[model samples]
Target: MIGVGKIKQYSNVLDKPLSKGKQEVSLSAFAFLFSELVQYNQTQVDNIAELERRLEDAGYAVGARVLELLCHRDKGNRRETRLLGILSFVHSTVWKVLFGKVADSLEKGTEHEDEYMISEKELLVNRFISIPKDMGTFNCGAFVAGIVRGVLDGAGFPAVVTAHFVPVEGQHRPRTTILIKFAEEVLRREARLG
Candidate 1:
């Protein structure tokens, strides 16, 4: 026989409110775990591009769940349907949830109407990473790109997202910029809606 307190009551556990989607892990712990993820993926891939894609795929899964949670808990289950709406949500809300801060910048591409970029000085994923000399231009932020893509795609704004490293004047390490090129259908839909 168990004591009164020792007996777990399902009602008590069920009565508690759900998290507001503000959960976080320490940066050090995240770095360690992310490193392990990279190391494990390294063994399975033949090249850096493949590894990055795999990581992006993993991030995509996380992003989908994140959208589901945030929609239910924080946003009152409202989904962003407009292009700018979803972009803002990903740039601000998603980044804040995942990285503890909003993205440094979200800008439209000067050369393309359908392209946008989310730039971060030192993205959380790339902060602790030290790329090998052989792995030229391999930004760990591909995982983050995946997250952005996942969120956008899940929210009915399908787009092609890629991560790039852009040199900043006087900065030793380049910043990670996520480039999002919306699908033609998405662009058409946007124009019609506007």
Candidate 2:
């Protein structure tokens, strides 16, 4: 067994409650941190896919914690049981908390009943990022996709979330669309309860 060194305990920090009032974080700070995260991940991977996967993994962990904290603070420690209800909560409440505003649009897939899309004109995480031309099919929104997946999974609605860039003719840049595909079991459960 390895001997453990004396560690300073900060139990009071854990005991403190999260503030219910609107708390804001500096956008510049977030941007710098995200930039560092991308740079660090990029160095560890050879391809765009691997780099994106690393970012998603990091975001997933953050999402899980954020979901729990938000639910506890705002939902009276209750989880949304309905599919549409959860989606609406994420679209409005979660989006506001994360980005200081709601998403541009939320729509269901025309071809698939279990698929949903949340469109954002500009994803906050991708604001200051500039992808190189060599990195084919790279969108920093993949991190947000992982966050969505983590939240849904934590709330018992397991789903796959992917980020896609859909260009709008008049827009300055392509919009980021988060495509969510709920699991079969989740849909079945929703149907049974609904």
TM-scores of the models, in the given order? 0.90, 0.88
The lDDT leader among the candidates is 1
- lDDT per residue (tens digit) for residues 31-104 in model 1: 99999999999999999889999999998998888898778767878998888889999999888888889999
Per-residue C-alpha lDDT of model 2 across residues 1-194, encoded as one tens digit per residue: 22567544458986556567656899999999988888899899998888878888887887788789889989879988899988988898888888899999999999999999999988999888777888767999999998888888899999988888899998878899999999999999998987
What's the TM for model 1?
A: 0.90
List where candidate 2 sits over 4 angstroms from the true fold.
Answer: 1-18
Worst 10 residues of 1 by lDDT: 13-22
Lowest lDDT sum, 10 consecutive residues, model 2, at 1-10
In candidate 1, position 42 carries an lDDT of 94
Give the clashing residue pairs of candidate 1, or none.
none
